[model samples]
Target chain A: MTSLPKHPPAKRLGLAIDLDTCVGCHACATNCKEWNTGGISAPLTDVNAYQAEQRGVWFNRVYTYEVGGEGPDARTVHFPKNCLHCEQPACVTVCPTGASYKRSEDGIVLVDHDKCIGCKLCSWACPYGNREYDEHVGVMKKCTLCVDKIYNQNLPEVDRVPACVAACPAKARHFGDFADPNSTVSKLTRDRGGYDLAPETGYLPTSKYLPPRPGKRSEAMPAAAPAPAIAGAGRFLKWVDRVLTR
Target chain B: MHPAYSVIFFTTASGAGYGLLVLAAIFAISGLMPATAWLGFVTNGLALGLIAGGLLSSTFHLGHPERAWRALTQWRSSWLSREGVLAVATFVPAGLFAIGWVFLGTTTGFFGWMGAAAAVLAVATVISTSMIYASLITIRQWNNGIVPVAYLVLGLMSGAVLLEAVTRLFGVHGSHVDVVAIVLIVVGWLVKLAYWHSADTGLVKTTLATATGLGRFGSVRLLEQPHTEENFLMQEMGFVVARKHARRLRAIAQATLFVVPLAATIASLFVAPMVAMVLALVAVVSLAVGLLTERWLFFAEAKHDCMVYYGR
Candidate 1:
């Protein structure tokens, strides 16, 4: 089962992240943890929760980088990263057990905890470092794309998107069926020039990231006229006149 | 990249085990080694013991050791799965050969064919093991042509030295074995040198800019990490070794693994049987230390592609 699906999936459900608007607030990350901890892959396992060396498994992480040089074009980019649900995910194929797999129907990669041996080879195979190891459960965990919530009939249709996408305050994360040409994610990718992370790895990630757009300088305002030269007494009188007029 | 001890031990020990099995089969089939029950028992016992022990040790690092049996189910796509399956299947022929040789005191006919089968399986298992590392394109240092070659040669070399020590201790001497050991020592070290040279000179294809798809904006640099504390990715893949220490360790590995073993093996060819036995034993010990050091370095020096995210 670790072998890839013989045929490509018809639907590629994925997210398109806008780096331009992400505030690096980590709200999506925390919301993802909050939802997923009690969702399909429960108990994210925070070790030493209150200690100085606190560490645990998390599916999404945000990183800040200074791109370009110290000039007008320079910008600070907040990059939020997670599993891209690659079409040809090496993490699935490298698994010795048939635990890691991609759904042929939707192209969503998932891990079956019961079948995992916890060898961690899948983690090594991932270039994006998206897979997280749960020390307590002794199994690999990752972004499920809120599969449980997305499919639940009890939840409102508006709440069916991924927890991260729904929780993004700035609407930086957009989730939809990328396989459809008219889908929001697909159009966003086309319009914003969204790109795959680590494309050189050849994973063909389904998710895309919209690059940060450069800031625009306003050119509509006119330059102010210089004040007329005046003698000391006249300048004082002018200042008094200006103050009184104000 | 964290250099887990269990994995290092498993690779080195099982590699040597398979190598010994191959050599033992060749010796028996070609009439190089005497067909004695005691010798057969000792040789096969040692080979199987090392193999089984190493394989068991490999599970020590697994998070769910109780679920280790599931690892054998995915051979169709996974090299690690293939390795596990091949390793276990090898035991069948190897066990039969051992029984035929030790109990029946024969190294010919059906038993000889069985030995041949075992040898082929052993070599295949080692190759599978090597492929587990080589197939990983994420690590530039491991995804190379020379990794499997170096692993095979070093395994064989270590086996040859161990065989020499055991045979000499039993008062059985073969000049051809000594020559083979010396040749393998030189050849194995040469392959290892090539591997190290490539690792040293190879440029990392993935960088922060490429990793984040931000190269078009010019050079990208990490202004702030994702978290203030180290996460699982950082702890598991962020391990870094200072260049100075790596160089020193490489020299030590060269001296102990190649220089000393090669010298001792050659000198054993000319000395008295007792002195030769001692020298062979010394060679075995030195090779063991050197192999461990080299294996440690193998993990320590490897930089995972994920490390680019951590600014490693």
Candidate 2:
């Protein structure tokens, strides 16, 4: 069952994240934790909560980085990373048990707690580090893309997207069937040139990240001329005096 | 990458175990070894005991050891599953061969064919074990040709040393086994050194820019980490060893595993039979300690691709 499906699924459910607009607010990560803590992979336990060193399992995380250098070209980019639901998810295929598997129906990678022996091999096989082992449950856990909520018949279709996508304050996260070229997520990817995290690894990740926009160049400021000797001497003497005092 | 002790023991012990079984099969099939009861008891018992012990130890690291049997179900796609299946399958012919040679005093006909089959399975098991790491595309250091070569050669070298020690236990004075052990040790460590060299010079295919999809925006460096403290991924994959310490460990591994073992095997040739047995025993003990350190370093030095996100 861990083997890839013979035919690709008709619906490759995935996300399109706009890296340019992400502010690294961590709202999506928090929302994801809040929802998943009570869902399938429940109680993503934190061992040392409110302590100096806390460790836990989280499905989504936001990382902030400084790009380029100082000047107008310098900019901060926030990347919200999660499971990409790769078409060739090594995490699924490398599983010793059939617990970690990709759904043939929707192409969402998931772990069945019932069958998992918690060998942690799937995590090692994954290039993206999306899967985290839940020590409390003694099983591997990962981003389900809100499978419980998304597929719930009782929930309204509009409210059926992933918790992270719904909670993104900047609306940076988009959820739709990427298998359909006409879907909004697919169009967004096509328009913004959304790319995979590590294409060289050949995972063929379904989740795409829109690259940060180019920075604007600012005019360099002019240097100030040195002051005259007597006044400058007084200023220099004061600076020296301050330095000596410190 | 965490270098869990159980797994280190598992791979090392099982590898040597299978290696010895393969050699035993070859010796029996080639009519090199006489079907003696003591030899059968010592060799078969040690080999199967190591294999069983290693496999059991592997389960200790798993969260749900009770469900470990389920791992064999997905051999179609998983190397771990394939290894499990092959490991179990190997015991069948190996067990039959042991019964025939040790209890019934037979090494021909059914026993000979069974020994041959067991040898093939033993080699296949080692290959399956090596592929478990080699097939992984995430850890650049492990996903290489040298990893499997190192595993295979080291296993054989250790097994050869063990065979020499066993031969010395009796009054046998076969210089060929000692020479074979010495040759295997030299070959094994050379491959290991090559593996280290490759890891040192290899270019990591992915970087922060590519991982984040922000290369066009220019160079990217982490400004803020996702968490204040370590997470599961960080705990499992963020293990790092100091360069100086790694160098020291490598030296120790080389000395005890290769140099000392090879020297002892050679010295055993000139000494009395009693002294030679003692020298062979020393070689086995030293090799175990050295391989333990080497296996630990193997895990410690590996860098996971995911660490790029954390600026590691």
Candidate 3:
């Protein structure tokens, strides 16, 4: 049962994250925790909640990186990471129990907690470190892409999306079927040159990350010359000048 | 790569057990070993005991040890599952062989074939165990051709040393056994040396640039971590051992696992039967300590692909 689906899924539901727009506010991560703790994979337990060494299971995480060298060309890029729902997920195949599985219908990888033995092999198999082991529950958990809410008919249609996508303040996270060429995610991927992370690993991740676009600051503004030093300026005047110049 | 003690014990003990089973089968089939009921009980009991104890110890690290049986269901794709199934299946033939040899005092007819079957299954079980680590592409040190070969050679080497010790207890002299043990020890060390060399010099292609898909922007450096505190991923995969300490441990492993054991085994050959027994036992003890250190290093030195994300 841990074997991969024999046939490709009809739809690949995935996310397209825009590094250009992500603010690294952790809104998506928090929103995901907020929903998933009660949505499907509930009780995302945190160990030592009030202590100095607090840790817990989370489906999404945002990282901040300084790209390029320390120069004018250098830029800070906020990266949000999660499971790619890979086409060739080793995590699923490595499970001794048929707990970790990929859906042949929608290409979404999920963990069935009931069947999981919590041997932690799947965690070792994941290159992206997306799978989280809940010590309290003694099972593996990961990003479900908000499976429960995405297809729910109870809420308004506009609210029917992944909790992370719905909560992103910058509108940086887009979700749709990647298998469809005309879908929003696919179009965004094509137009913005979205790319996979560590493609050499050959997991064939479904989710894509849009590269940060060139900033307009370099093109629009030239370096300004330093203002002339005020000769023998009063202390009060020097403070005002310093504030104005800054 | 945490070097969990349970796993180290499991692999080492079970590997030696299987090796002993294979060697015992071969000796029995060739009429090299005595066909006494006492010898049969001692050899088979010791081998099966080690195998069962190691298998049981492996379950201690699992979060849900009670549900461990479910692991047998996925042998079609999982090496761990295959190992579980094979480990259990081996007991059938091995048990029958033990019963026939110990009670019936005959190993040449039906029981001999059962012993042969058990030997094959035992080797397969060890290979499956090695594949559990070798098949993992995430850890460069484990995903090597040398991993499986080193495992098999070391298992057999340890088993040979133990066999020498046990045979010496009965005042049985087999010069060829000592020669095989010496050769296997030398060959095992050679394989281990190659494994270490490859691990030390191997280049990891995935860097921070490739990990974050930001190579075009130039060098990428982590400015901030995703969480304020260390998470499970960091605690588990981000484990880093000091270079200085690793080098020291490697030296200790080489001395205890190889040099001391080899010296003891060679020294045992020319001594009196009683002295030989003591020396062979010393070799076994040294080898066990050495193997534990080596196994610890195996996990400690491994660098996981996910560590690149944590700036490790």
Reference-based lDDT, each prediction: 0.90, 0.88, 0.91
lDDT of 2 by residue, B216-311 (tens): 777889999998888899889998753449889999999998999999999988988899999999999998998899988888888889999999
Most TM-score-accurate candidate: 3
| lDDT at residue A165 of model 3 (Cα atoms) | 96
DockQ of each: 0.76, 0.67, 0.80
- Stretches off by above 4 angstroms in model 2 are A217-246, B242-244
TM-score of chain B of 1: 0.98
Model 3's DockQ score: 0.80
For B1-312, candidate 1 gives per-residue lDDT tens digits of 888989989999998888888998899888988878888888889889989988999999898999998999999999999999999999999999999899998888999999999999998999999999899999999999999998899888988988998889887668878878889998998999999999999988999989999989988888898888988888787777534499999999999999998999888878899999999889988988999999999988888998788777
| lDDT for A33 (candidate 2) | 96
Residues A62-127, candidate 3, lDDT per residue (tens digit)?
A: 989999888778888999999999999999999999999999999999999988988999999999
> What's the lDDT for residue A126 in model 3?
93
lDDT of 2 by residue, A170-213 (tens): 99999999999999999999998888888999999998988876
Lowest lDDT block of 10, candidate 1 chain B: B235-244
DockQ of 1: 0.76
Docking class of 3: medium
Which residue pairs in candidate 3 collide? none
- Residue A231 error for model 2, in Å? 34
True interface contacts reproduced by each model, as a fraction?
0.90, 0.89, 0.85
